[model samples]
Target: MTEQTTGRLKVRLVDGLLILIMAVLAGCGLIYEYLLSHYAGRVLGAVEHAIFATIGIMIVAMGFGAFAARKIKDAFSGFAWLELYICFIGASSILFIAAAIGFTFHLPQLISDTFNLPADVLPRGGWVEQLHQIARYLPYVSAACLGFFIGIEIPLIARVREALYQKHLTHNAGTVYGADYIGAGIGAALWIGWMMSLDINQAAVITASTNLLIGFLILLLFWQKIRWRLLLTACQLLMLAFVIVLSAYGQNWMNSFTDMLYRDQVVLQQQTQYQQIVLTERNLQLNNNPTQTSVLQLYLNGRLQFSSMDERIYHEMLIHPVMASAPKHDSVLLIGGGDGLALREIFKWPVHSVDMVELDPMMISLFKQPRQFLPIRLAKQVIELNANSLSDERLNLMYADAFNQVDQLVAQGRIYDVIVVDLPDPNHPDLNKLYTNHFYTRLQQLLNADGVLVVQSTSPYHAQDAFIAIGKTIADANFSAVEQYHQNVPSFGQWGWSVAVKQGLPVSERLKHSLAAQTMPVIKTQWLTWPIVLASFNFPQGFYKNYVNIKVNRLGSQQLFNYHDQAWRKQQGMVNLNSNQQISP
Candidate 1:
């Protein structure tokens, strides 16, 4: 080949490799951004807010990084260093945040011990509170840093490409920017399609590994022109080794860090496609006895579901009232009670069949499978607590969304004598649909002519507006009768339930009459009895009598979510105010 032809071919090869590097960088950058946001959401409450704020801060920081990239003297060295920095930050971001929060939480106790200050006398607005405030902002700060580093990547790659092809390359910006965009698209696809299935820490390690590989590739391709080639290669190899080590033991570190965040010992923690599931256990020793009283608790997305100590009260109140009042308890449909506690209650009656629809199979498996970490066998504990209801021959479990499953059941001409809506509260916007009038209407259609449906409404005392809105929405769904009741469960104070029947018979009257006739449940209950059920229907004078401003929760309007949010905020405000008052001089 001629010397001129050889030069041209070398330039073309360099150009292609640079473009490919940009694509890889783009994918890895976006993944890092998402990883920080997701981790923040998991650690902090208010997932929606955490995700939005982290992503927003990162995007803006990226712009700053891009603007700052103009100061780079050597594009090759800068890009390689940038990739190394990203790999380090992305791999360790979650660990850093967890450690920061853990430190913040313990700082107060450490200070108290250092100065020998009384725990009760810590200043109301003290260093401890200040540290907490700072901890709250750490996630955003970390996200901005990651975003800024990621932002410089594309600009640096563009400059590197320009230097490589010199006068031969035209439209450098187009080539660089196009590759970045396409690589980002692929990154998103990989994240949603595959990466999300892995544990959060595992996903971070994977992305970091990709970032390190990109750095190595760039160093190899331009080794002849690059300065400090051997040093850079060694650094890249060290980082790769570190990332591999993290992948093997990162989850254990995460669990230990997370355990500090909760009041109880975290026994099992898993990251599912939908949400984070954490199980905590507290063993209370009576008089320092070797035999301890263990309380197993389940939390989803950091919200407490049930504590073994008081779960029976909640489950009994949730299941027995409707089961007793239904005209015929031959067939039942349960939605969202994957723990099998309610199923245990339902199996008390000689029902011919029970169909259950729950969204997360991981939840079911966690409760059903054996685990070495657990103090007791999970399946055996569940069987003992739930009376072996899940293993019943007639129980049919459907791992699917309750909203779509209801439609499917309706289409197949399947109807149930009793329908139990044991779903989580409509604390999130996505859950609003399940509480909407339209969803309740569909549920009503699946009920047999004399069928009864019951929903576990949020606490009437704590979330009065939400409780009233749920009852109003169900009444508006064209059920013949709807009645709201509540029971005091220690785990969840003042929990509520709403029952509806298709025959248009007033549920209160039916329940009152049934109680007067001394009706008893065929199956024994720990906390629920005819008198207790009757008393649950009675609220304090004017408790709900004047709640006329509550809005009906419709599919489009989703008023329940707003009501729920407002009520919880008010409750939290009261709690904070009381706490401050208690600590004041």
Candidate 2:
């Protein structure tokens, strides 16, 4: 005995449960990232502002939670009840949100709008309004509860340590931090592997159980008397169990309703770590064989990414200009694009070898196996992805790394005769870095003097300013000049692309349209004419010109958290569905 009451053996239990509770608290951050993106995509008319709007609100709420922790007068036994409350909040979160959106917003919109019902009678315009309400405020609530608990645990564990033996706050903090990091790692793995598959209801149940069990363990270790507060906690959980069952059942109706609202000829839907991958088809071109039908499209995170049919416009734009300008085509590197469209273009050249490096093994697996992709071409040579391998000698030409991922390759001093960057929009800051001044300068360093780099900028017509900003961003990065172009693709609406070189002109500007379009295995975009090329750079004076002031950084920066990404779909005038819940974050 270190001259304390029998109260001191409580140390081990409090420390262990502190680890567990903090694990649950840290869960909020990762889960927030995934759910914020998912919910924003689900809602119609959501802007780039919403991602920032939600994140800011949640962090503020966490501060509020830390402030509120000062008011809790009772310690130890009373604090144990807070763990139970945390469990309840964590478990019910996904269910409450998904069910609310699925039923309240999505279902009624499809059914009522299709049948033509009165808005006064039902929650018309569906759950987008409701989900907006949730996304705007609910995150704050989540942070408050999670943060309050976390703040208290720091002091509670400190009290336990002081009660046992004298250790400085710094030493205790390190131990707590070590345990928290390890627990968060475990939780992240479980979240990706298991929670991703479970429906919103089941996800809640699992989350709730993890929290409640942790709470029970905490109480058992610290509090000897099982009081009224513990009983209340049990009863609250039983009621939540009932809510979970109802919400899960409601979501069944929601899924069908959401499908009809979008009217997707949905080909595939998978939640990968990268983003939500959805493949869809529209029978626009009528054909004799019903089996061999219309165009197939790919959507990532609710935005139209690419279509298999006219994707040639985007891919050809990315490939041909660079290939024609490059000194040699001995070796090539492709990243992120596991779709095999970019690979099809590379094979068109007389290249010695090509390395298709993709981060997600799933994308490569899909291309390699016909059963997985169903008619999609396989990759040339799918290699395991790692940033360290960028220094490898084999690659003479590279495509696939998004602007954010390009930094590592740039730092490695990997040079290429030609570089093709075909990533999703700079709708968020993370994607925007690749288009920034710093990234372009790094890109210029990676390209040989004669090397030409072609970047797939967004639609010149829809997002001309952002497109111009990209051009200027490269100009700021020390590239002498930037070339721009636009092409019509049904799946992507009106899209734009640009090519930048260190010391040479793009082949299109220098040479005439002398090379004839040859028939290829995939679609050939020989239709790329001088008229289209000239018109691409011709922007109306009315276009927004904020590109002059924009600043781009390498990391801990913007996250492209501004440029509204779902632009094309909004341009196409697409609509979305219903939702579940009373609680907002």
Candidate 3:
């Protein structure tokens, strides 16, 4: 009975040690992903190289470490030392990757981005090779140190159990593996949930510091000897210094590198499980500051989500027609349209209450900032809520679930009198889904009686097939439809919109009738004249032939995406993404 009790105690201790090692290893994977995305845009570049490189390096390194694990049979109790070494290696790997790419491509672009210059002026694209070199070298170093310690620690843990409490090696290994699983899960959860909320440099420091603390704690348990306590304290102090110094100086290094790559100011930054969100601020006008104006703007990923100079087109198109079509425009509900442009237009009407439910909080924070175009008045109207919230009796739902076409609201049973599908073209699968027959049918359930739905399809000419598909989908959903074009935005070529309603009426009638009077508080300031209303319907012969007969059974959503992608490939200095083919404003 005494022997069995002692043996069980040994197994528990071994398990604890193994858990610590696994936590450190799992952190490596999390930190690696976070850093890479921050350093490079997730969508662009050769991510395949980094991913394949990480896996290849880790597996190969793990194999070598596994062999080392078997060889260090007698010296296995030194798992504490292995933990300290692996933590250092994992933590330092960040700087290794950063330094490699930092000066090469990223920093130069950051500086250049501060000013707008002619094309062929920016650095050419062969920076991937330098990144490949970094990826090739850094992962091997991390894997060698991480894999070696991880492999060696398991056997060391088993040996310690066998010696300290006389547990068998097999029992020790099994017990330790269980702890390993639990610790890895915890590490993964923590990184995704909280660590990812930080910038890459911050995430790296936090993750590394965590490992160091845990490593010291494990040492305290295993190293009962007085002499080893000094070593543990010294190691902890070293890690503390590492985190503090890196925290202080690391950001400057990172931003410098990023500036070079993007040729823009790397402003607001965060790492998520999937990607890095960077907000860049470019001083469009340096010599003179525009008073009562926003000189700086924010960009997400690489796309220009918002600008201070003007967003009249984005908002006017999204809101004006929806308001023009809706019953009374009393209470409003906006979902996922966080740029505040849609809300800006909504504020133009005598809206009693407005609720905007944006999914990403980070984006909202950026929205609250004062831009020349994004006034506090626009941001104030929002009753900010998440998309999954319920609509009250007051909500005249205004839906804009069209980012990359992955409209979560489409599936969620709800209807609005005014639905504005201001989404990107059918580029990715998610964006394409919003243009599908299934999505329109889902949207049908949410419309109020006699409600009007405005969908921003791609160009009426360039992406004519995609534009046609949107109309067909709305028709398939059993809604009477009318299509229009307005080129208010120069960024996107001529933009398009499809208005689908429960009742068939010439869109021009509803649009004309819905104009706000001069007496209205919001409308007193701006122009919503009947001239703009007349111009919206004056579609050319080309747009008419484009949407001739697009049907559900024959859905080629790719036509729009392909056209846009090809145009993008053409790369004649600019492409319009914000407004459709024919925009009206």
The candidate that wins on lDDT is 1
Model 1 stretches with alpha carbons more than 4 Å out: 1-3, 111-125, 168-171, 227-231, 285-293, 371-379, 541-548, 556-558, 570-585
Output the number of the TM-score-best candidate. 1
Clashes of each: 1, 32, 38
Which ranking of candidates, highest lDDT first?
Answer: 1, 2, 3
Q: Write the per-residue lDDT of candidate 2 for residues 464-548, one digit (tens) a residue.
A: 5566666666666777667776666655566777777787665555423334443222324544543455565555575546655
Better candidate by TM-score, 1 or 3: 1
lDDT of 1 by residue, 262-331 (tens): 7687878878877778788787778888545567788887678888888988888888888878878999
Number of clashing pairs, model 3?
A: 38
What is candidate 3's lDDT per residue for 55-163, written digit by digit as tens? 5555566667667876654443356566667667656665666565445444334545767655446543345434433543554455455655556655665566566
Of 1 and 2, the candidate ahead on lDDT is 1
Give candidate 2's TM-score: 0.69
Question: What are the lDDT scores of the predictions, listed in order?
Answer: 0.80, 0.55, 0.54
